[model samples]
Target: MTLKSIHIEDTDLQIEVKEVRKVSKIRYALKKLIYVPDADLKPKIITKILTHIRNIIENKVKEREEKDHEIGIFIAYKGKFIKGMVIAEDNPHYSSRNRRAASFGWLYAKDYEVCKELMEACESFARKRGKKLLRGPINFPKSVGGYGLQVEGFDEQLIYGVAFNDPKTAPSLKEFLEDLNYKQDSEYLSMEVTQDRWKSGTQLDKDIKIRYLTFEELNNRKDEILDILRGAFYSVLPDAFGMERYKEIMDLLRNIPSHYYKLPKKIKLENDSVQTEFVEAWKKCYDREVITFFHLAFDKNTDNLVGIITCLPDLYELWKDNPITRVNVDVAAVRKGYGRKGIFSSLNNIGQLTGNMLGITYYEGTSIWNLNEDAIRTILPHGRINRRFYVFQKRIKNPT
Candidate 1:
């Protein structure tokens, strides 16, 4: 791919945008050495940044080879690399109109002025590609991209699976995007629930049975699981992945080895009762060290899948203690007819119970859209709001 370069007069910064086919190890090391300050925050902070950077490079290369999607990386430099962003063209399964988006992350800059120029370059690059609308801080897809900007709740530590930038940079980036006419497209709220607050109230109808997917079942019935996910989120997230892309993503996730996860061994309750049942459930479902948990609700009368909740071990925290202390609730969806039947609440109750049994202290749930009042209500009872993230978009004046 060709490298595109431009100069911003306002900041006197030279900007370059290019497709990242290969990232040199030396350059990667240099970035780590230069950008990371030698301070108390260096070790944990640097590791987080480096891990994300590596993922971006690898995904960009794979995107290029597939040729089904378009992705590019942009960098701002005066004498050296100051800012960077990633842009991609997304084809949602349900949307008829073509869409393009960009994610600005691993964002480290000297000042806000440089950040502004970097963002402008990203917008220009997207427009040149004939994109009508642009949305992000999202990497490649909503599932993997860690969507949104941290608009509120700055006092807390960053959680796993959620996107975050340097406290210094995040506020300025938000200000720049707002000033540049990027309107708020969407908002997601993050919240946490304590094990004590996770009380079970109403139960599902007698006909409805809650079931956990075994490792063998996950492999044999992967397609059904994907279908349930796509159907559940189709209305709420119209821009969800298409069938082909959905399968591709699942395949990638399924291939993850066991060692990457820290499995739950034993869970004890406040009553001093040992929860061996929870440990046995986990053992039955987890064939490897993968940290994903899936719970499905089935309607016996129709013998159909009605609801699903997916959770994964908070990788950031897991790696630190080598234990499943926290979990990130990735997605929770109920089929149309299944709504208002307490399926959503039941699934969460099960999640909390399972997590508690495994010694998990907290559960992190995100991407709860502002318009989703029902979901917000369901979560509010069990979790406290920790952070809010926003997606901004602007329409291009003229398409190619």
Candidate 2:
């Protein structure tokens, strides 16, 4: 294990930062501490930690193989794992506006002093890389672990794939970052609505046709689906989603263990007269069973996919014997020119109907940026805000 020690001024404690490369070492080190509060869930939590570490390694390998960019991970330890972070030059070649930044997550510190030391370590690491700014707990990439810190609505249940910090630990971390002059760089909200509430009065224009796809269908037409996904978020988040990044995302999705969860056995359409092309496509591409839900909107005249919304069972919630009744809406996007044609509304209407038919009671919407007025307006009538998360950023003093 490679270690570096930095003395905490005016105190006897010294912070030790280590670069961990082996999954076995991480597992052995983590075994010494109780990372999760629930005894029943500790094993699963450890699996998740190991999985994240493996992903970081895989990401680095991909970067090297593709000759894309450079990235690194650091873990701060004082007898045990206190905090960990990842730093990267985020797709510098892809966009001129891309900032040199670090993504920090899996932060677990007991007190402000340790937290302060961890933040300083992160800043120093970024400075050494000639980074101009630092922004995180983004966990390497925003698509994998999400962005920002949860500052409000801690009483709510956790959403799948979204980062969760202990309520008590959250305040101290926030205060320490503020003390160090970090400011809120961005904010997102998570909202929730029952299937009944969302399905009551929602309607779509007659010209729009709603279609559903299974995991097999999605995998078969991966390129087309990826194009739609890219086009939808291109204007809003150009820097993040490229062809390479999209491939990484699809790889992660395909590796999920679908056999453990219960998926809908059949598609029960509310209207049988609706075009059967999507269903026929699914039949042709049907392969294995995977728990995934996709609702796509197409123009009846042009037969072009205009919008899409996807949901997956909350795996953590399902593991806890929660009946797997709630599905988290992971992505919702519409083509630029088709935004006002009720494409989004049509997708939502189908989403609710499908959820209800599958015995899903709740639908969770996350990563809803405050600047997205159209999305906010579309969901406001159906759901209420459950929680808010923020991303903090600070300018580095020196570039080199």
Q: Per-residue alpha-carbon lDDT of model 1 for 242-265, expressed as tens digits?
A: 454445435434644454333444
Model 2 scores what on Cα lDDT? 0.60
Candidate 1 lands at a TM-score of 0.74
* Candidate of highest TM-score: 2
Which window of 10 residues has the lowest lDDT sum in candidate 2?
A: 88-97
Candidate 2, residues 154-248: lDDT per residue as tens digits? 77765565555667767877787788788876777888864443432244556767655555666676676666765444345412334544554
lDDT value, residue 236 of candidate 1: 42
Off by over 4 Å in 1: 1-22, 25-65, 81-113, 140-145, 195-202, 231-234, 238-292
